[model samples]
Target: MLIFIILALIITILVIKKSKTKLQKTLNETVSNLNKTIREKDDIISELSKYQDIIDVQSKCDELLSNAQNEAELIKKRYETLLTFAQIEAEKIKEKSLSAKKQMDEQIKIRKVEYDNILSTALEQSKQIISDANIKAEEIAGDAYKALNNHKELEQKAKAMKNVIEGYGNKYIIPTHGILDELADDFGYAEAGIELKKSRQKSKFMVENGLAAKCDYVENNRKTTAINFVTDAFNGKVDTILSTVKSTNYGVLKQKITDSYILVNNLGEAFRNAVITPEYLQARLDELKWAVAAFELKEKEKEEQRLIKEQIREEERARRDYEKAIKEAAKEEEMLKKLMAKAQLQLQEANDQQKAEYESKLIDLQKKLQEAEEKNQRALSMAQQTKSGHVYIISNVGSFGEDVYKIGMTRRLDPLDRVKELGDASVPFTFDVHSMIFSDDAPKLETELHKIFNKNQVNKVNPKKEFFKVNIKDVKSQIEKMGIQSKWTMLAEAKEYRESLAIENEMKSSEEFAS
Candidate 1:
C-alpha cells in the first residue's frame, strides 16, 4: 500500500509539475497578448489625439466660417442700404432732368417762333435791298457807259494829235511819202553817187547865179559878203540836218531836214532873196538821202561780218571738241587694253580661286574694251561726219521772260557744255534744258524747228537770234511729229529765279514792316 501511495505522490508531483509548466506558458502568452493590446491601445490613443486635433481644427474652421458668414451678412445689409440710397438719388435726378428738359423744350419752342419772325423779316428786307441795289446798279451802269463814251472820244482825239506830231510836221504824210520814198523807188549806190555829184554842181551854180540870195548893198565887196553869208547859213543848216541822220534817228532827222529848209528859206528872205530855193533844197535833200543810205549799208555790212565771225568761232570750237573726243577715246582704249592684258597674264598662272577671279575680271575688262572700241569708232565717225551733233532746246526765264526759248544745235561731244557757256554771266540765271536730242543731222533739225516757229521768233529782225516765243508743248509736239524719241522737262525749275523773287518779296515785306 505504501509503494502504491509513493507512486501516487510521485504521479501527483509530476501532474503538478506539468500543470506548472502549462501555467508558465499560458502566463507568457497572456503577457505577450497584454503587451500587444497595450501597444494597440497606445496606437488608438495616438489616433484619437490626431482625431482630436482634426476635430479642434474643424471646430476652429467652423468658428471662422461662422464669423465670415456673419460679416458677409453685415456687408450684404450695408450694400443693400447703399443701393437703396443710390436708387432714391437716381430717381430724384431723373425727375430733375425731366423737369429741366420740359422747361428747355418750352423755351426752345418760344425761341423758334421768335427766330421764324426774325428770319421772315430778314428775308423781306434782303429782297427789298436786292431790288434797290439792282436799280442803283443799272443807273450807275448807264452813267458809266456815258462816261466811257466821252473818255473814248477824248482818247481818239489825243491819238490823232500824237499821230500828227509823229508825222514829221505833215499829218497827211506817211513815212514813205517824200524824197525818201522817191529815192527808195529807184535807188543804187552808183546812181546815188551820180546824183550827189549833180547836187554839188547845182549848188555851185545857184550860188554863182545869185539865185540863192540877194543883198541891198551897192558896193561889190559888201554885196558879195552878204551873198556869201546867206550861202554859208544855208549850207550850215543842211550840214546840221545831215549830221543827225542815223538808223534809229531817220524819222527825227527827216523832220529836222524840213525845219532846217524852212529856216534857211526864211534867212534868205531876210537877205531879200531865198538862198534855199526849191531847187537848192532838192540838192541838199539828195545829199542827205545818200548819207543815210550809205550809213545803213555800212551797218548791214558790219552785221554780216559779225555773223561770219561767229560762225567761224563755232566751227573752231566744234573742231577742237572733235579732236578732244578722239584723244579721249584713244586714251580710254589704251587703258582698257592694258587692264585686259594684265588680267589675261594673271589668269595664265592663277590657282582655281584666283583663276575664277581673274577670269571674271577678264570678262568685265573685255566688256569695257568693247565699249571703249565702240566709243573710239563713234569718235572717229563723228569727226568724219560734221553734221552729227546734238540739238538742244533751252530757256532762261529770268533773262528772256516766259515763252521765250533758244532752239540751237551744237557739234560738241557734250552738248550741255555749250548750253552752260550760253548761260554764263550774260544771263541772270542758268538755262533750263527742255530737251537734248542727238541727231545725225542736227543743223537740219534745228533749221526745221526754226522754220516751224519762224513767225514766233522773238527777235524778228535778226534770224541769228534763235529765240522763239512759243509754248513748250508746241515744241514737244513738233519734235514728236518728227518721229524723234526724246525726254522732255516740260516744267522749268527756274530755281534761282524763283528764289530771287522770294528774297525780293521778303525784303519788301521786311521794309514795309519796319516802316
Candidate 2:
C-alpha cells in the first residue's frame, strides 16, 4: 500500500509542474492583447477631439457671415435714402431755374415793346419835319424868281433913253443920271448893266458846266451889287431928268426912271430873299420810276430765291430724315439677326411660350427691315439726283465774324439769287460775293475747295456746310491754284444793313432819353 502512495505522489508532482507552465503561456498572450487595445482607444479619442475643434470653427464663421449680412443690408438702405434725397434737391433747383428764366423772358419782352413804340414815334416826327422844310424852301424860291422878272422888264424901259443918247457915237459918256457926268459917274449905268449881264451869264455857265454847286455864293453877291447900282442910278436919274425936263423934253424919261426905282427896290428884296441851293445830283431814288421798278424786280427775285432755298432746305431735311431712318433700320436689322440666331439656339432648350415670342419678334423685324430698305433706295435716288450748281465764296463780317466765309454751291439760274437769299432774314447783313464759279462739275470743285480748307472747316461732318475759318488770302491762293478765273468783290456794300444799324442805334438813344 506504501509503495502505491509514493508512485501516486510522483505522478501528482509531474501533473502540477505541467499545469504551471500552461498558465504562464496564457498570461503572456493576455498582456499583449491588452496593450494593443489601449493604443487603439488613444487614437479614437484624438480623432474625436479634432472633430469637436472643427465644429467650433464652423459656428464662429457662421456668426461672422450673419453679422456682415446685417451690416450690408444697413448700408444698402442708407444709400437708397441718400439717392432719393439728392434727386428731390435736384428737382427743386431745376424748378427754381425755370421760374427765373420765365420771369427774365417776360421782362425782356416788355422792354422790347417799349423800344419799338419810341422808335416809331421818332421816325414819324423826323419825316414830317424834313417834308415841311423842303416845301417851304421851294415856295420861297418861286416868289423870288417872279419878283426878279418884273424888275427886269422895268429896268429895260428905263435904259432906252440912255441908249438913244448913246446912238450919236458917244461911247465914252458916263451917265449917273439921264444926263452925262464927267467926274461923278465913273461906274455908270452902262457898267452896272454890263456887270448884271455878266452875272447872269456866269450863272448860266455854272449850270451848263455841272458846277452849279459853286455858283450859289457868287450869284448871291452879284445880285446884291446889281440891285444897289440900279436903285442908286434910278434915284439920281429921276432928280436930274425931272429938273431938266423943261429944258430938253426928257420928261418921259423921269417917269420911266421913277418906275425903274420902284422896280429895282423890289428886285433887291427878291435877290435878298433868294437862297443858295445845292445841286440836284441826278434825282431822288424815289422819283426815278425806272430805278424803283428795278428795285421792285430785285425784291421779287429775292422772294423767288428764298422760296427756292426753302425748297432746298426741305429736301435736305427729308434726306437727313431718310438717312436716320436707314441707319435705325440697319441697326434694327442687325439686332434682329443676332436675336434670330439667339432664338434658334434657345429654341432647342426653351419652353414653348419663349420660342413663340422670339419667332414673332424676328418676323416683325424682317418686315420692318424690308420696308426700311425700300425707303432707303428711294432716298438714295433722290439724293443722287439732287442738282449741283455754281460754287460761291462769300463774306459777311456783320453776320459771321471776319475770316469766316461761306463756301457754298447753288443750282439756280442766277447765283446772285442764292447770295441774296443767304443775306435775307437769316443773316443780319448782306453777304458780299467774293467769288462765284459756275461749272458743270460744281460739286467736284466745291469738294476740292472744302478739302483745301479741311483743317479750318467750321462744320466738319457735313461737307455741304462749307463754312471755313481761314484767311481770305489763303482761300484766294487755293482758288488760283485750281486755275479758276473768278471775280473778287473786295468792297462790301452792305448799305441797307448799315443804315438799319444806324437807325437802330438812333432808336436806342431815343429810348434811353425817354427812360
Candidate 3:
C-alpha cells in the first residue's frame, strides 16, 4: 500500500508540471499580443495628429474667406453708389445739350437766310456787268470794222495811182483833140494856156466818166489783197507743215502734205477775178515742194546714219562671235589632243582583253580629236568669210500675236544662242524657232526675205524692225523662189501663253462660283 501511494504522488507531480508549462506559455502569448496592440494604438495616434493639423489649416482658410466676402460686399456697394451718381449727371448733361442744339439750329437757319440773300444780290450784279461789257464789245468791234474798210479804200487808191505811174511815163501829158492844133499855130501862148485848159478838162472828164480809172483801181486792189492774203496763208501753212513734219510719223506726212496742198489751192481759187495769178500760185507750190523735199532729205539722212550705226554694231558683234568661236574651237582641239595622248599611253600598257577595250577607246578618242581639229578649221574658215552666218525665222505669239515673225541673222556658231537672246526679258514669252538657214551670204538672204515681205512689215516706218506680218506659207514660197531649201515649223507652240490663259480662266471660274 505505501508503494501504490508513492506512485500516485509521482503521477500528480507530472500532471502539475505539464499544467504549469501550459500556463507559462499562455502568459507569454498574452504579453506578445498586448505589445502588438500598443504598437497599433501608437500608429492610430500618429494618423489622428496629421488629421488635426489639416483641420487647423481649414479653419484658417475659412477665416480668410469670410474676410474676403466682407470686403467684396463693401466694394460692390461703393460702385453701385458711383454708378447712380454718374447716371444722374448724364441725364443733366443730356438735357443741357438738347437745349443748346435747339438754339444752334435757330442761329443756323437765320445765317442761311442771310447767305441766300447776299448770293442773290451778287448774281444779279454779275449778270448786269456781263451784259454791259458785251454791249461795249459790240460797239468797239463795229468801229474797228469801219476803220479797216476806210484803210483798205485808201490803200486801193494808192496802189492804182502807183500802177498808172509805172505803166505810163510820169511826165507824159494827156492828148486833147484841139489843144495840139492850137499849140502848132501859137507856140508860146498855146503851151501855157493849153496846159491849164487841158488839166481842167481832164479833171472834168474824170469826174463825169470815171469807169476806166475805177476799174483799174478795183483790179489793183483785188490783186494786192489776194497777194497779201496768199502770202500770209502760205507762211502759216509752211510753219504748220514744218511742225507736222517734226511731230507726225513719216507714213502720215505724205497724206498731211496732200491735204495742205488741196487746202491752199482751194484758198487761192476762192478769190475773184484771177487775183491769185497762176504764176504766183505755181511759185508758192514750188516753194512748198522744195521745203518738203528738204525735210525728206533730212529724214533720209538721219535714217541712213541710224542704219550705218546699226550695221557697225552688227559687224562688231559678228567679229566678236567669230573670235569667240575660234578661241573655243582651239581650246576644244587642245583638250582632245591631250585626251588622245593619255588614251594612247593607257592602250600601250593594257592586257589582251583590256587592250581590245582600250583600242576601241583610243579609236573613239582619235575620232574626237579629228572632229575637234575639223571644227577648228571650220571656225577659221568661217571667220575669214565675212558673209558666213545663219538666218533664222522665229516668232513670239504671246507678245507679237499670230502670223508675225522676226527674220534675223546671226554669226554665232550656235544660232540658237541669238534666238535665246532675242527671246529675253523684254518679251513675256520666249520665241519659237521656225527655221534656221545656214548661208554663206546670210545678210543677202535676210535682205531678200525683207524685200519680199516689205509691204507686210509690222512697222513700215522703221525698216530696222525686222518683224513681218505674213503667213508661213508665203515665207516658204518666197524662200523657195530664192532657191533656198529649208525645213519649216509652221505651227507655233506658245506653251506659256496657253498655260496663262488656262490659269486665268480657272481663276475666273472660281470667282464666278464663289460670287
Best by lDDT: 1
Clashes of 3: 0
- Pick the TM-score winner: 1
Clashing residue pairs in all predictions, respectively, total: 1, 0, 0
TM-score of 2: 0.25
Which residue segments of model 1 deviate by more than 4 Å?
A: 1-230, 246-248, 273-275, 482-485
Q: Which pairs, if any, clash in model 1?
A: 212-275
lDDT of 2 by residue, 1-515 (tens): 88889989989988888888888778878888888888888999887987997899899999999999999999999999999999999999999999999999999999999999999998998899878766776687787755565686556545654554543243323222332222143544344445445554554554455442222225757755553454344435444544443233223343344344444444444455322222211111111222223333344456667867976785565566556666775776677677767767776777887888767776776777677667656545444655545788898877777788899876554468678877888777888888888776777888788888888987653335568998888888888888887887765566666788899999999999999
Error of 2 at 114 (Å): 95
- The 10-residue segment with the lowest total lDDT in model 3: 208-217
Candidates ranked by lDDT: 1, 3, 2
TM-score of 1: 0.58
Computed on alpha carbons, the lDDT of every model, listed in order, comes to: 0.79, 0.63, 0.71
> 1 or 2: which has the higher lDDT?
1
Model 1 lDDT, residue 120, Cα? 100
Pairs of residues clashing in candidate 3: none
Model 1 poorest ten-residue lDDT run: 170-179
Candidate 3 lDDT, tens digit per residue, 181-273? 333333343244444455435434433442111112257677566655654564465456546544444333333433443444445656652
